[model samples]
Target: MALDKQDLLFAGLMGSKAVNLIQNANIVNNELINRVLPVIPFLPVKNEKNNVTSKSGHAINAEDNWTTRDSIEDQKQFFPLSFSFKENGQKWLFPYEPMINIASGNSIVKRNVAKQGDKLIGTIKERWSRKDFDITVTGVLIGSIMQGKPEDCFPREHFSKLFEFLKHSKEIFIYCHPLDLISVNKVVVEDYSFPFTKGENVQAYELKLTSDYSYELLIKDDF
Candidate 1:
């Protein structure tokens, strides 16, 4: 069947409009992808609480009452970050965004059994009643190191030794509270001190570890 000129022109216009619609959709999709990709690191929620130890060797749950800005948007704007290392090719990359646990106020005690001078004995007695605290770190994993070569991600040297240790391990151990699993975020390492952030949306996230450290070793050995 033969179509009139007007009908043919209308069909051509519709086709052009459809093509423009598709191009616009593609552009929108690409923009969304780019916006979301960089947000992955900040997405995982990390929750941590405090534990207090008594001089009698008993431990108690201490409140995690550290305060921070309420909104996630505020956190994104003000989150303080430190650097760590990852291996690439023949050298190490500095300042990789590796997962780490920051534990504060952990302590150990020793009893004095020997009798001493009056002042010394008094000091020991006072010490026995006092509690000590220190900060310790554990469960460091380099995300960029474990993942494929970063397109242009810079690495940091602070994590060099930790990266090496993870490289040689067969299995990494994670300790976490059972209750944390059911919460919004999974706790990666157990018994780590986490500062408190305020707001209704505040939550916790679990850190990732691997049973096979070989992958880490391969990446580190690349350098």
Candidate 2:
């Protein structure tokens, strides 16, 4: 069916999969962890291979018939998202976009090549390395409530979950989306930077992770 402008726009918006979620993270100490961040307003990167050079000369060296061959080579995927929070009478200013890293297996070619007719037949299958990813969540903390009193500006309890995670190691499930999940990943805090003033606010946060679950586990959730 031919699509109109409105249809195309809707597909672009919905099919883009702008929405993403992190189901739940491990608890460090007694502080609760943060989940759910906004996907940065940008296009998701996809590394794709449309064709491959023929290594086997089955067709008299006539280009080896590279028709219907493609693949995606990125084993790891990264995303930039926005996060903000208001707590302890202080509102943290989201200075810059935060990046979330996702690890995935590569797509592979599963075609049967006929040496006589130079024909290729089969399907492209995406191989998932694991369902779980050991992901470290980190972001920048630029500005906070400036007009508040000293006591209010600095809460009695600092947002120390990051520190707790650093000291206490734990594995938790992270929902990449509602149906998709990265489960039982060892999560930790790393590469934290002190706040610095820039045009907006700039600071850095980092997390370290590893996983054994498949990246596409959600597809088979029913089983």
Candidate 3:
């Protein structure tokens, strides 16, 4: 299908996946994290590769049956923050993010204090380094809200995936509205742990992270 304003809007919300419109639209609504106002998209012409009828199973035209993703639609709601960070082109959709805090600063010191003419002065020094950043994110996972089947809504798999990231030594690409405010693209998981919670099927998680920025030669010599 030809591109149009509606298609672009879908692109803005779903990223590249908008082309598929909503794959699995046939699935139950509760199974999907996107429980928001429905938006329409113009799907591409069905080809052999997309024989490929997973989303909605209708490739001929845009469908009003599709709904918007909570995470992608807005961040101000904060009831359930959507996918924040990704790695290798995959985004981690947070079911219900309660809070996300980012703290950033730099170390500048004062030295060489001296008394001169009944006055005191000190020299200030700063090193060429990236600003320090610390991030904390808390989210609640719910499987018993009758939102979906336990197999689909449970947090056990989410917990395992989170642990995998924590155990991974390498830095992972991360982005959210808050992280974007400070230009933080990647971070190292300093510590991760599960906090006390009150639900039989609800799990709370706490993730601590420090920023990681690899410096590259921005000014290359043009020969």
- Candidate 2 per-residue lDDT, tens place, 111-210, comes to 5445635353454344433334435454543222212233322222223433443454443333233114533322333344433322121224555655
Q: Which lDDT value does model 1 have at 141?
A: 21
Q: Output the TM-score of candidate 2.
A: 0.30
Q: State every prediction's TM-score relative to the real structure.
A: 0.19, 0.30, 0.54
The alpha-carbon lDDT assigned to residue 37 of candidate 1 equals: 16
Quick one: ranking by lDDT, best first?
3, 2, 1
Q: Write candidate 1's Cα lDDT for 77-161 as tens digits.
A: 2221221233221322212222233332423355575776666653233233322212133212222221122321112333333
Cα distance off (Å), candidate 3, residue 207: 0.9
TM-score for candidate 3, residues paired by index: 0.54
lDDT, residue 156, candidate 1: 30
Q: How much lDDT does each candidate structure score?
A: 0.28, 0.32, 0.52
Candidate 1 has what TM-score? 0.19
Better of 1 and 2 by TM-score: 2
Q: After superposition, how far is residue 66 of candidate 3 from its true place, in Å?
A: 27
